[model samples]
Target: MSTPSHAAATAPRRRNETVIVFALSLAAMVVSMMQTLPVPILGLIRTDLGTSTAGVSWVTTATLLSAAVFTPLLGRFGDQHGKKPTLVAVLGVMVAGSVIAALATSLPLLILGRVLQGAATAIFPLALSVLREEVRPQKLPGAMALVSGTLAFGSGLALVATGLLTSGSDADYRDAFWMATGFAVLALLAVALLVPAPRHKTGGRTDFLGALTLGTALLLLLLPISQGHEWGWASPRTLGGFAGAAVMTAVWVLVERKVDEPLVDMRMFVHRPVLMANLAGILVGFGMFANFLGVSYLVQMPEALTGYGFDASILRASVQFLLPGAIISLLASPLGGRLVSRRGPRAALGLAAVLGAVGFAWLALDHRHSASVIGAGLVVGAAVSFGYAAMPAVIMASVPHHQSGIANGINSISRSTGSAIGSAVVTTILASRTLDHLPPGVPPLPAESGFTLTFGIGAAAFALVAVISRFGLRGGHTTVAAAEPAAADHSGRPTDKAVRTDTADAAV
Candidate 1:
């Protein structure tokens, strides 16, 4: 069969576009659920597999690392080929992985399954790219917000499902994987039936070398972080891994500048808004995960073991935090869209950054007291949701449509890396400090202290993001207003009146 021509392939139809958005949103929700499903079942997985804590931990780490390595590569592929096929392929991989995990007899096999499962993470960026092309300019912001919010909702639901499904039995972890498998199947079917074939295709060589360099660098960095304590942090292996990661990252930067089709367009970093958004994404990601991790420990800590002592089971604990965070994310996402529409992406982003910083600070300060801790978490969750949802809007508004996928993939990688670093840093601190203080049979206190310290660090990081968002993003408004009209014209919606009004106002 002959390849479809670019214009004929991408020509937007109103009805098909809406269906595509819905399909993509559904896919995003399915993919995001993978991130949180293992949380409630971590202890059970360890016990059943007869795995060391470090070995079992790889189940989650492997998935994040795989997603970090694959997301941009898949996004670039979608840009060159088409989104529908790429998304379907990823979903299929996730289903296969879920099935493998459900049937696994060993921790190694389960880790392999998790790696395969992580491929679905790319579906989120691919969906965003598809929506950027299919949706109208006016509806784009809201659609993007809805899509992003689905990620939070899915994650929360997955946690709840894990808790409910795994409550009384050690075998229940398998049920969680089955649930994921079912979601994947549903997403794949929806995509096949609803998402129309592409009308346009872009031709570009896959940046295989760039992908290798990035993948290698990420592996080097993440391996040590995920396994350093198990391997002995002071050991030669750990030091070597960190050294290799740094060198590889430097080499990748050099190689990226020379390549015709770099996996990530490094030049995009020069754009003030893009740079600021990415930086903010990193900080927001760090803070978000740190908070989640800390709260997980807090909720799971037995009443005899901790302050604000409650005897809630894992299921109840997961549900309590999950519901509030999900609700806040759901509410904030649409509000971010409205804010972007009224003021600009910069304003919305700034507001999110400030809110995140404040919320995290509140959580840190109120560590020992009050039910307001949950409210603080909700605020932080909402702020992160708003920031993340607004970022795609800014990137899409700033860049060309064809490059949206790669742009978003790079953004995704930043978030992933941030999370990896946060997990490593937080866990390391907790482990190191607690090593000395465990009273004979008593559980650890350093873990709890580390949780507090990590949140404090996260709060500081987000505060910095707030500063950058306020200053770094201001330049984008003028640039966007200037570029948006031309982009609209190319999309066959001339912004003549808006341009004229903007120009007149500027002159005055």
Candidate 2:
């Protein structure tokens, strides 16, 4: 149906789109790897840096707090200025941070490096915006799913890689950071070379006040969530953190309502579908971290002392137990994309909920066998991929093209917050119930019942995901629709090709 010139033009465009997607996926994977890289080597880090457990905890905590502060602000910046520049700058920061982390001699320097790496969380939302600009409507869901799947895949892969690298007696934690640096360099090059400039930038003033208040609220909430195990649930510091978060959250809302160009729109934030998607993000995030921590701890328990478990070394647990699920998640992503494209994100979310519940139920009831645990983890991994695939669709469909990056950024924050809560909950639950009658001078080990209870709690979280999908997300499915005639490009000139994709309902 096309002339030779038309066909030739289309082929390269398609190739370019493919490159863009690949680059974005790499960047997204790197962001997830940053979160999990130091996890398996925290012990080594503490020993090498001569820091206490509480001091080493900052390696992870610094990244979380940094992401909470920077994701939305940078996301909005990309939306207003340009995605490509923002992405390149973020990746640059990640590379520098990785280098510093790899070379650090003290805990403070390592934490500073992690803080910069954490700012790259903005890459995910900015990547999504780039997809919206370039990919065709028919192929968009698949592209988004592939990139989203990398989050789960990268998370598990980082654990495995860290285990392998640190398996020797003389292993240095800095080796993990070197690996991160290599990946960050690759991602930076791929993105800078392949991705095109933005065509739909919406110039606006940054809302510094709203950004500050929101960042403070998240910091307060996450500080308690991450540290409650050390602080004690009833401690004044923990209680004060919760109260402070609540008050700052109220202040953030007020600031957003008053700002002319807000960091987050109050109405859109409260929209039923968006609200439900965020709720699902939290539950899914919780289940994801819970699965990782609970399974890792359970399998590594010494069988002789615990009366259960496989006594898996960190390497064996990461490679033999967790790697399969991570691979399955990557493999299932295209299917999830197809599911989202055909059945809508709501249906995909429902399927994720069912699968997650089933997977956790299997683990809770029959975790004694390796086959059962691996098979169950595979299912949960796929469920996470599906949930990740569906969330961006809901967010992209609910917000205008101009607000896509910031909106998705907010959703990403919700998931991170949930992950922090999940880690804290697991720590508290396992510590609360340990084996009785342990030998003198032997460290406490979690009872088998603790594993069961943890999995049960994970199942409940997924069940909540189902409830949200069924009751909260209502109305017809919507994908990216063509931009209205009045839509303007970065130059303030009308553009026919730009899309403003949002869900439409007579009532909603």
Best by lDDT: 2
Which regions of candidate 1 are displaced past 4 Å? 1-18, 169-171, 232-234, 368-370, 435-439, 476-508
- Return the lDDT, model 1, position 356: 77
User: How much lDDT does each candidate structure score?
Assistant: 0.75, 0.89
Locate the minimum summed-lDDT window of 10 residues in model 2: 492-501
Best by TM-score: 2
Show pairs that collide, candidate 2: none
- Could you report the Cα RMSD, in angstroms, for every candidate shown? 6.0, 3.4
- Please report how far candidate 2 places residue 119 from its true position, in Å: 0.7
Model 1 lDDT at residue 124: 82
lDDT by residue (285-317, candidate 1, tens digit) is 787777777776666665454543245577776
* TM-scores, one per candidate: 0.88, 0.95
What are the runs in model 2 whose C-alpha is more than 4 Å off? Answer: 482-508
For candidate 2, give the lDDT of residue 139. Answer: 88
